[model samples]
Target: MTVTLAADSGRLPEYPMELDSAQSQRVERLLAGTVISLHDHPIRLPDPLTAETWKLHSGQSADVFGGDAIVRSGLNVVLASALAEPDQRRLLSWAAAMRPQLLGPELSGAESLALAMRGEGSAVLLALEDLGSIGTDLVGIEELYRAGFRSAGLVYNTGNALGGGLGQSTDGGLTEPGRRAVAMLNDLHMLVDLSHVGDRTSIEAAALSTAPVVISHAGARSLWPSARMKPDDVLRAVADTGGVIGIEAAPGSTRVSADTTHDLDAVMAHVEYVAELVGVDHVGLGPDTFFGDHTQLYSAAGWSPQPVPGYERLALPDYVAGMENPAEAPRNAASWLVRRGWSDADIAKVLGANAARVLESVLR
Candidate 1:
C-alpha cells in the first residue's frame, strides 16, 4: 500500500534542515553519547529484488563517522550487530581481547563503554542479530556478559530454541530456555531485545522479561505495513516496559516508494510515526545500514531469507536522504523535528536519551 503524505504536508521536503547553535550542540552531544546502529561492523544483506548484495566497504564505513583516525571518536556510542554466534564472539574479542591492538596509540570508545555503559566519551556497544550463537544457557550468558557483551535479540528472522522469529510460520512464545534466558539476562543486567521476533514472541518477550526490551531497528507497521515493521499495539507493549523502538532507515522499511526512498523525508516519516505512536521518549535512531558505494548510499532490506508476502519488491536505490550514513542521520532528524517545532528536550530523547535510558536501566 502506498503511503500518502498528510494532506497539508504534500511531497517530501528538500532536506538537510539547518540547525541553530543550541540545536546543533544538542545533536552533537547526542552523537557523542549514543547514535545507535552505525552498522560499524559487517552484515550480509541479500537483496533478491535486485540480486545485489549489501556490504559496507571498509574505507566507506569509516568515512561515515569521519576518517579512520576519528571514526571511533566521531561515533560516541553505537550498537554493533553481529548476526551469527561466531560473529558475536568475534566482536566481543575485538572489543576486549584485541581493542588495544586494533588501535595501539588510540583506544576505542568501545573500551570505555565496555567498562561502563554510561562511562566517559564514546564507545561501540555489542549486540547480536539473534541468540543463534550463544546457547540458551546461563553459563554461556554469564561468560558473554563478563566478556563485555551487552544486549541481544532472541531471534533474527528464524525461529530457534529461544522462540519464533518474525519469519516463523507461527510463534508459540518463549521456549523453556527462552524464559530462563530472559530471567538470566535481567539478573546479569544484560539487555533483552525483540527486534525481529514474531508477534507472539515480541509480546511474550516484553511481558516475560524483567528488564525493558528494545526493538533495536524496525519501522512502524501502521506507517508502512512491511513484514519488518511493528504495529502500534506492539510498540505500546514495548513502551509500557520503558523500552525503545529505533526506527530503521533501510530501503522499503521506511514505507517510501522507489522514487522517494532516496529522499530524506522517507526516513523522517517513520521517526514521526513512532514519536506520534508512542512518544518522542520511546523513539530513537537505528539506521541498521551504512554509507557506501552509491553517492546517495540507499540500502534495501530483504526482510527475511525467505520471501515476505507483499514485500518482495525492494529494489536497491541510488540514495537514502537523511540516512545516507550515521553522521547525517541525527542532523537530519534534528532538522525535521525543528521544522515540526519539537522542543530541544524532546528532540534529545528521540536522538539518544531513550537508548541511554534502556542501557543505564538494564545493563549491569
Candidate 2:
C-alpha cells in the first residue's frame, strides 16, 4: 500500500493509499485493458510552503497512472487563469516562446501506449487545457498540435474570442471564429473538449464538428444541478456525435445529495446517470485530479465554483474521498464499477477503449 516516488529523484512527492485484498484485485483487473482519463491536470499542484507561488515540480511516480494499462491523457494547463498573474500578456508571450521546448516531442495517444507496453514510461496524451494560449490566431492550434498537444478545450471558464465558457453571465455561444476553430481542430485531427465551455457553445461546437467532441470532465446536471455540470441535451449532443462524457469528481462538482463530503459514490452516481441517459459506450472517467490538496489549491488560486440560483450556498469538501489525486482516481473508478457488477467489456469501454476509439479516429 506504499506508493513509490517518481523514477527521477527530482520529482514531486506522492502519498500511499492502503488497499485491502479485494481492492487490490479489483485494481489489477481494472488495469487489464487500456484506460484513458478524458481530462485532468496532472502537473498542477498546490505549493506547500506558500500559496502565493505555484509548486511547479517535475516528479511523477508510476502511481500517477496506477498501472501501464492506464493512459494519462487530457488537459495540461501551462498557466491556469486562477493564479491571477498581473501581467497576462507577458506570461502568455513567455508561454508561447517556451511551449515548444517544454513539450519536447509529439506523441500520439497510440504511440504513448506503445511506449508504456514496452515498460518505457506511462502513456500520456498531451493536451492544452484552453486555446487561450493561442490568443486571437487560428494558426496557434496547428502550432500547439505540432508542439505535442493532441486535444484542446476552446475556452476556460469565461468568454474568449473563440466562445463563451461556464463562468460567463450570459453565454454568447460560439462565434464565427469559434466555428472556424472547431473546423480547424477537426481538420487537424485533434480532439475537441467542451468540459469548461458554456452550454450553448458546447452544443454548437459539438454539432459543428465532423469528429466526435468530448466533454472531457464534467457531470450530469440532472443529478447535481450545478452550472458546472452538463445538462441532458448537452450530454445527448456529445453522445450523438459518438463522443464520451467523462464524469467529473473534483470536490463538490458531482455530489448526488446534500452530503457534506464528496466520495467515490457521488462520482459514480454521475457516471450511472450519464450512462443511463446516453448509454455506457459514451461514458468514461475524467476525475480531473492532481497531486495536492485541491480545495486548498482552489482557495489559494482564488478560484471558486460558479454559484447557481438556489444552490449558491453549497458546501464544498476538502478532497474527494477515494479519489483525492490522479494516482487514485482510475483505480477507484474501475473498482467501483466492478463492485457494481459491470461486465468486463463494459468496464473496458469506460476505462479507455471508448476514448481510445475517439482518439484513434481523430488523432493524426
Candidate 3:
C-alpha cells in the first residue's frame, strides 16, 4: 500500500520520496472524498497554485479532472489580462481582496492546495491580461513567454495599435505591427488567442499564425452570431491548423435566457455543433468564469462593453445556479459529457486533454 510521490523538477527544487502504507491510505481516502464532494459541481479555483500544492503535498491526486493523466499533463492556463505590473506586495494584496469573492472560504483550503500545486508545476496557468496604455511590448511579451506565457491575445474588446476589436465599426484586420506581434509570439512559442479579436482580425490572425492558435473563450457564430462567437468557417480554419476552439460558458456567448431552466442541454448543443463541424478533438471549454465584478475590472482599465448584437448578460446568479465556481466546472462538464454518451476518453479530452494537447504542441 506504499505510494511513491514525485515532485515536478520545474517547481520544486528537491523531489520528495515515497510514502508508506498508512500515509498512502490516508491520501487515498482524502482523494476519494474530494472527488465525491465535487461531483457534478462546477467551481473555479481562480489560483490553482495553492490547492494544487496542498494536494501534491498531501499525496492526493493533482489532476483536476478526476485523475486523468493526459488531462493533467497538458494542464496550463493563460490569463486574459496583462494590464499593469503590480508590485509583488500589491499582487498579494489584490489576491487577498479577491479571494473571498473568487474562492469562497468554504473552498479556500482546496483552492490553496490547487494554487500551491501549480507553484510546484503539477500544472501551469498564466494570466494574459490586456496590456495597459503602455501596451504589451515585444520585449515584455517575450520575457513573459520565457517565464511561461504560452498563449496571448492582442486586445480584449477594443481597437489598439495591434488591430481593431469585434466592437469596432471598421473591423480592420491585424495592423502591420500586429502581424509582427503575432509572428513574435509564434517565435516565442506562444499560442495566439483570438477570442475577442474582431472577425477580420480573427481570420487574419488565424491565417497568419505559424503555430497552432486558440479562441480561448468563444462560442459558435451559427448558434449566436455575436461578435464573441466565431463563424463556422473560422472554427474549421482553427482546427485545420491543429489548433483548438474553446467553447465558453459565459451567458453572452450562449444566449441563455434568464428565465430558462438550468438544463445544460443548450450548452451541450453548442459543444455538439462544434464537434460536428471540427470533430471532438478540436473542441474544449474556456468557461471564462470571472472572479468578481469583471465588468468593473474592464471598465476600471478603460475599456467599455459593446452591445453584442445577439448575446445576453451572463449574470452571476445564472452562472452560479448552474455551476457555482471554477473547481466545480470540471466535474459538471464531465457529467454533462457522460450523459451525452461520451466515452470517458472523449469526455476527458473535452474537459482538459484537448487543451493540454494544444499546449504541449505549442509550448514545447
Residue 121 Cα positional deviation in candidate 3, in Å, after optimal superposition: 6.4
Per-residue CA lDDT of candidate 3, range 36-147, in tens? Answer: 1101112212122233343442243321221232123233332323233423333234334333432334332223335423543223234353322325355656655544
Runs with alpha carbons beyond 4 Å of true place in candidate 2: 1-26, 44-49, 53-110, 113-120
Give per-residue CA lDDT, model 2, range 1-364, as digits (tens): 2222232111333224455687667667667556667776554343361334332322221113222112342212111111212233433443454443333355554565555445455555566567876667888777766655677888878768899988888999999889999999998888899988999999999999999999888999898777889999999999999999988788888888774457888898888889899999999888876656667766655677767567777767867887666656776777778777788888888887788778778876
Tens-digit lDDT track of model 1 for 191-252: 78788788888888899888888898887877666667887878988998999988777645
Each model's backbone clash number: 6, 2, 44
Give per-model CA RMSD: 8.2, 6.1, 12.9
Two-way TM-score contest, 1 vs 3, winner: 1
Query: lDDT values of the candidates?
Result: 0.62, 0.69, 0.52
lDDT of 1: 0.62
Error of 3 at 180 (Å): 0.7
Show model 1 residue runs off by greater than 4 Å: 1-15, 18-75, 85-98, 101-119, 135-138, 256-259, 291-308
Cα displacement (angstroms), candidate 2, residue 333, comes to 0.9
Best by lDDT: 2
Cα error, candidate 2, residue 328 (Å):
0.8
Better model by lDDT: candidate 1 vs candidate 3: 1
Candidate 1 least-lDDT 10 residues: 2-11
